[model samples]
Target: MTTRKDYTRPLDIKHGRVDMGHGAGGRAAAQLIEEVFVKAFDNPYLRQGNDGAALAIPAGHRLVMATDAHVVSPLFFPGGDVGCLSVHGTINDVAMCGARPLYLTASFILEEGFPLAELKRIVDSMAAAAREAGVPVVTGDTKVVEKGKGDGVFISTTGLGVVPQGVDVGGANARPGDVILLSGTIGDHGVAVLSKRESLEFETTIASDTAALHTLVAAMLEAAPGGVRVLRDPTRGGLATTLNEIARQSGVGMLLDEAAIPVLPQVDAACELLGLDPLYVANEGKLVAVCAPEATEVVLAAMRAHPRGAAAVRIGSVTEDPHHFVQMATRFGGRRVVDWLSGEQLPRIC
Candidate 1:
């Protein structure tokens, strides 16, 4: 339990830096959580001042939970920071299950000497993201590590939601006759983050495509219930790796039309200069949907109607192949295997 002892002085949020005392589980810790976290993520369950949140799930729905860690470098990126990324990443994970996200729990590992202003900025971003997504951060844990022993700050978040009955979405649900749909252009997030790095340079700026996707998902389910068989957000390894995973899991293969897969011209140019395959790049706000052939047009239409998926297109179709290979028909009329990323292409990219 936290002891709310009256303090005579307020924390200097402007010029103050975090110290070991903030995570000591005493007055300093209490004050930090009360003034900062509580102020931003003010909600009934969180204001209860409990170690865990008490939540109620919708009746007749199955529970869904997903967690993710945010350690992207630069902390702040063109379109998002580690804060919103932490919230969006976990929320997307839960939403991918065809669930309605309800609550979130956050855990922070703060490096001693990290600036209080930066911390507050991140927390505020997280709070805003939760509010916009209609989810609340009801509980969380905070810890401090010795300087140089940890990054400025690392965040891990878990989201909980309820999936209505009759909805089934997963990697293993993909079938040989399924049609593949991509949410939008690829490589935007990866290129945006990489452009911020000291080693890379770009003439034209690209922003990360980070956004909450649950609403778009809801629209699809509402439009064609039981039509979507598999849904995945191509994050770390981008389109190729994610598709390969789905193919292997479903004991099937995939054939992609390179010309149909959308890629922004600037992003394509940047990848060409860097010798990076856009297919293997990372994307934060995009998703891939595999639906039954009969429902492809309906689902595609639904996706295009949503703001997050306005660029949705049919990229390929699942096929029967014992090897479970993901091959793409190139614009040059030749086909090649779209294999898993051979090694780390970009590091510290979430």
Candidate 2:
């Protein structure tokens, strides 16, 4: 005979709608938690009903915190959705400071009348991503907006990390002659999301490279201690905007070899068809590293060894030009100025 525990049919997750009861502090909310959040993100800390989580910190390391909000249109996209992107985006932000991400706090703004099934899918994805990255969402808040006032859902994540002593990395640290390295192909994330948005079918599907890159950064730092000058993830404004920010912050110039930059042919073709500049496209799973020239090879080797950076390449170098300009040498043997993006090309991309 099936006991009540065994007969609890998972809260009707398939066809149920998210009514106001889901956000109410009542049995309905508890049922949602028990069936969805608890099931997806099982952990000792979360199981405790305290208002906050208790964690132990390691000695000699300073904690780093970073937060990001995700309001990307079309919650579901190729290779990732808003759920996984939320986790990776904040994790990457914390890791860009050369820290080891430890914990995450998430907030959800949900729309009433949304499908419980979809919400569960997104939450499951977020839980899976956090688990895979070895981070836990220790605390979270959920609020429901009237049906039309909000998108399907919006997620904001705050990440906590530990930065080791004597390791410094920032946009202001790029020095002249530092080699610039790209983790892998550019424009993949942006194009992937764009394709899904426009329903633009392609011969070969392009998937977003949405991933947490802290481990890759750790490996690179270990291989070339003190040689890593700066690190930045090219997300919103893409490589051009990110490089320009670094150049202006460090008061240096950059010269990128266009041929050395990697872009999938489908992405390039899509960009051409859409009149979009790949330089200004967005990326979720790539990093731009500015390292000492002597350490470039070692850093590249280290990056290639990581699953997140298997296609790492040396793409450019910092220069001493006074204008803090970023220029690219095209494959046609001509150079063109790569300036900061004038306006948002693809807004709400992250």
Candidate 3:
């Protein structure tokens, strides 16, 4: 089905915007794919030009997969955008299961008049993130919706990874006396998105902590094989809600040290001005890892060794309680039970 006409011209990536014809499965579509997506995310598997990618899985390894859809408002933010967020979110999800992300697939839904320049920026961001994570976008799809019917753009990403043997980490594995560790500061991503969405200018700006956490997870596993009990990236509901979910699943209670948990000063000020609790705000780049007490130092050391988790520290411990509640010891030397967020704190945050 080679055609001379389809190759007559190249896409106008500089000034053109996506049109309905780009998604119509015609010559326009082919040209768009050839010029934009393929050019940005060129790899051997993607170059195969097949409907599905053929991946050679390693023997004696179990496959782990996760999918996430990103609909964040203000596509471009301080730290990242929908493109990198799409890749990082799903990669973190797979890594939370103690897997090493290997490949990714992304699908895009574009509005009629979405700028091609913005699309190129997003695509380039995604390609860079995937390459940095050592994962390739092997296959993908693109669709267009009418103006006013859809947001500027929406990205859905799916990732595949391989879980090593003798490594079992999940929400239901935490037990009493297990130590809890946090990867980095809390509420950076949520605060960054909020400031951008509301056009609020703080004295100091905050950036989203969106990042791929598989490498950090890999380091922790290397430090202590089978020592990590549960690993979760606190995203939507923040650290409190994530801990609650794990406690309920593991049928145990949690105790957190408020003084030990990290929070950026700018983020603290933003939350104070907005009357928001940092614990309930979202975080895209941080994770909650519960491990055995004996291996806590080793895991913490390993986490601190990675650039993504340089500020990682032990923040809490698990306890025996029939009620499976998450409690926090305040900096004021008082204890308060940390409950779930009443409702959505920040909406449209990835």
Tell me the TM-score of each prediction against the true structure: 0.96, 0.95, 0.96
Model 1 lDDT vs. the true structure?
0.91
Among all windows of 10 consecutive residues in model 3, the one with the lowest summed lDDT is: 1-10
Q: State the lDDT at 283 in candidate 3.
A: 92
Candidate 3 CA-lDDT value: 0.92
Error of 3 at 292 (Å): 0.6
RMSD from true fold, candidate 2: 4.1
Clashes of each: 0, 0, 0
- RMSD per model, one decimal: 2.7, 4.1, 2.7
Q: Best candidate, lDDT-wise?
A: 3
Report residue 95 deviation for candidate 2 (angstroms).
1.0
Per-residue CA lDDT of model 2 for 148-213, tens digit only, reads: 989889999999999876678888999999999999999999999998998999989999999999
For candidate 3, list the clashing residue pairs, or say none. none
User: Candidate 2, residue 61: CA error in Å?
Assistant: 0.8
Each model's lDDT comes to: 0.91, 0.90, 0.92
What residue pairs clash in candidate 2, if any at all? none
